[model samples]
Target: MKISIITVCYNSATTIEKTILSVASQTYVNIEYIIVDGNSKDNTLEILKKHENKISKWISEPDKGLYDAMNKGVAMATGDLIGILNSDDTFHSNTVIEDIVNFHKKNDIEASVGNIVQHRENGKIVRLYSSKYWTPEKLTIGFMPPHPSIFFKAALFNKFGNYDLGFKIGADYELITRFFLRNKIVWEYSGITTTAMLVGGLSSSGTSSYKLITKEIQKALAMNGIAFSSFKIKMRFFWKIIGFLKK
Candidate 1:
């Protein structure tokens, strides 16, 4: 199946080149590379222009935010499958996309995801989060596959809808929960590593991270039609700390 990889960026001149090269180097030939930039003031647009020949489609203009940029990319995607790679992230290796496509084809899966390595700004690998074979119960306790490592059938978007622009930091989390938990989309868990994501991303940084996570948990619980208690939320945070420690 043809796949479209979207990279949404803004003022990411220092790192956008690596993201572009990662997608361009993919071994999968039937891939579409689309970049949506939010009118960056930095050299991000210049870098994109330099690689314009490799990009299937690119646009640089002001956008509502990251999710809005992603929505724009989704609207433009014409491939059978869609995946997103953030400007600060890269595929684990050149063959990653090829492997994902092969696995999906062989297994007849609607979605596929693998492991992700979280790395430092200087490209030092920090932690690895693996995608467990998914189950509805796992989502209740906050287990989620890394968003960048996920590839889903594009038609799923038509049924479940796109990322909710109403969410600032937790839109992706909400989307995943809505699909995997509420809508019960079929997915395959590839045991291979897919991407290396930069640590300290918006959802994992600063005091606001806590606020956004709280909102995410609420969103997930509401979708699952379950009531959440403060104690359970605290325990979930405790388990998250434990997961980090294990890393």
Candidate 2:
């Protein structure tokens, strides 16, 4: 099965090349690598050109936001399965794509979720984000599999729709909850660490950002008609602390 991986970025030159090389080194052959740049002002564009041969398709243009750029990348994809890799993340291993494909085929599932190692810029591991502990019911508590480690059959997007542009930090959480909870897409854990994510990204920042995302998660649940309590949502941070200790 062909897999399409999309990396979305803006002024991400500091770590974009590692992300590019990670995908380019994947053992899976029938893969398409697409990058959507939000008209970066840095050398990100130059780096893209330097590794142009590794990219199947790429576009440099202004976008509404992160989710908007992701939507553009999805529109450009032609592979049967699609996954998004953040600009600051890299595959845990060269065989990650191959492993994900095998897991999906073996289980006969339309989507797959794996684990991720969130690490600092100095390459210090922070926590292990695993799908084995995730469930659709956990959405009420603002929990989700690491976005970089989830892959879905492209058709699922056609059925459920793209990320809601209304959210800034929680769109990934919102969309995943929508698919796994509301639409009930079939998904299984791949039992592989798919991505090594940098510790600081859109959703991985500090306290103020966490508060904003918590509010957005609540909004997402309400929008989906899912019954949730603010207390349950706040408990997600407790689980997050557990994740760090487990790591």
Candidate 3:
């Protein structure tokens, strides 16, 4: 099966090369690498050109934001499977894609996800979150798989829909809820680690993290058509704080 991996970037010259090398060095041959740049003013485009031969398709132009650029990449992708790799993240190993394909072949699953290692800016490993087994109830309590480690069949997007551009911070969470949680897609958990992600991502930033989590809870409730009391939401936040404290 052909797998399409997309990297959406903007002014990411510092880490773009590593991301490109990670994908290019994959053992899986039936892969398409696409990069969508939001008109990066830095040398990101130049770096991409240097590895143009390895990349299947790339576009550098002004766009709305991260999700907008991701939409363009998804639209251009022709592979049967799709996954997104942030410009700041890299695969855990060269055979990660090959392992994913082998798992897909063995199991009749519409999507697959693995574990992720979160690393600091100084290249220090922080925490490891495993996306082994997931359910809607787990999601309601604010548990979510790392988006970068998720690989879904391209046809699933057609059945569900693209990322909701309406949400700035929680669109990925919303998509996860809609496709995997609500619709109950057949997803396989490999238990093997997949991606090494940079610690300081958009969702993990300062006050935005709180805002995004609140929005995610609201979106989850609305999408699932569930009524949640304020007390329940507060309890959810309490559980989240407990989870963080334990970590």
Which prediction has the highest lDDT against the true structure? 2
lDDT at 17 for candidate 1? 97
lDDT of 2 at 242: 86
* Per-residue C-alpha lDDT of model 3 across residues 166-190, encoded as one tens digit per residue: 8777788888888877888998788
CA lDDT, every model vs. true structure: 0.85, 0.91, 0.86
How does residue 127 of candidate 3 score in lDDT?
82
Give per-residue CA lDDT, model 1, range 1-247, as digits (tens): 7899999999999899999999889888999999999999999988998999889999999999999999999999999989999999999999998998888888877788778999998779988878765455566766668888889899999888898888878788778888887878888788879889988787888767876687677776686575556456546768878766886
What TM-score quantifies how close candidate 2 is to the native fold?
A: 0.96
Q: Please give the range of 10 consecutive residues that has the lowest summed lDDT in model 2.
A: 235-244
lDDT of 2 by residue, 1-247 (tens): 9999999999999999999999989989999999999999999999999999999999999999999999999999999999999998899999999998888888978888889998888999978878897889989988888888899999988888998899988899889988999888888888899999888788767999989999999999999989998997887878778876996
108 Cα displacement, candidate 3 (Å)? 0.3
- Better candidate by lDDT, 2 or 3: 2
**Once superposed on the true structure, which residue ranges of model 3 sit more than 4 Å away at CA?**
229-247
Best-performing candidate as measured by TM-score: 2
The global Cα lDDT (0 to 1) of model 1 is 0.85
What's each prediction's TM-score? 0.93, 0.96, 0.93
